[model samples]
Target: LPDIEGELCRIERVRDVLVRRESELRYMMDDIQLCKEITRLKKELQKLVSIPDKDKLKEDREQEEELLLQINKLVETRDFLVDDAEFERLREREEDREMAASLQSKIPKALAVQGESDHESVI
Candidate 1:
């Protein structure tokens, strides 16, 4: 009987330690997520500020708004985790395509537009 009680006590202690570790891991995950969100927001703000063309900046207003919305949502949701892996993947793909298009348009496309309107349309 004493041996059984000792085993049960040991199991309880192990369970308690596991529970504590799990809680710590949850906090750490939250911290990591928060940091990632902050970094993303900073990068987005930097990009928005660095755009040389007013038209390009205006075109990216919606993206900036979305980024701000995401940041705000992250700030508000203290307990809930929002996974944005899929969204990030899609956004990155779109940005890559836009950059490719923009670069391709810069040479012959700019000369064509030089005769008409001075404002260049951004992808």
Candidate 2:
């Protein structure tokens, strides 16, 4: 009887650990989803830095040289901006800011709803 009770206690302890682990897994899954979302946004933002020349302006010698310099600079910046790690950082930061802003915006509305519910309960 004592061994069986000890085994049951051990099983319950394992069950508790499993439940806590499951909750932690769920949170990690959310983080993974957030990372995935950040990746997609980074891809989208990188797409904005297109590698195409769309200007069809004719230029004098000085103007053409200036144009070329500007184009080169843009190309270099685009190259740097399109990096995976850079994009990932930018996307994650932007997502965090957006999430914060949304939470801020919801606060007032949530307060209003809570107030309404409280008033209704009193009535």
Candidate 3:
């Protein structure tokens, strides 16, 4: 029973690691999906993998430069998107800050004064 419990704990740890790895992969996939070129490269790579002939490999080698160029373009696109997303986040933060400042300004000073007076009366 003790050995079984230890094995179960190990399995649970492995499952946790696998879950985290899967989530990381999902995030990577989502990121890749933003670039159409990477998707095309992936499809080509899959096709290459499926074809198990030396002749096909030689022919595929001819397109390697094109594939790499597309991959690099995709990388550049991803970098631009990351920057755009950061910019959008900062914009949202600024908007939220402005809203909070506006709300704070509108919160009645008269109510604050009345609350102070009430507190004095209670004392």
- Steric clashes per prediction: 0, 0, 0
Please, what is the whole-model Cα lDDT of each candidate in the order they appear? Answer: 0.69, 0.60, 0.71
Q: Listing every candidate in turn, what is its Cα RMSD in Å to the true structure after a full C-alpha superposition? A: 31.9, 18.7, 15.4
Question: lDDT tens digits, residues 5-42, model 2?
Answer: 75985797678667656755665565566556555645
Can you write out model 3's per-residue Cα lDDT over 27-77, one digit (the tens) per residue? 567576866668879788667666656657666765765676777878887
Sort by lDDT, best first: what order?
Answer: 3, 1, 2
Tell how far residue 120 is off in model 1, in angstroms. 99
Candidate 1, residues 5-54, lDDT tens digits: the string is 75985797678667656755776688698878878897986798677665
Best TM-score goes to which candidate?
1
Cα error of candidate 1 at position 72, Å: 0.9
Worst 10 residues of 3 by lDDT: 19-28
Off by over 4 Å in 1: 52-56, 79-123
Q: How do the predictions measure up, each by TM-score?
A: 0.52, 0.37, 0.49
- Best of the two (1, 2) by lDDT: 1
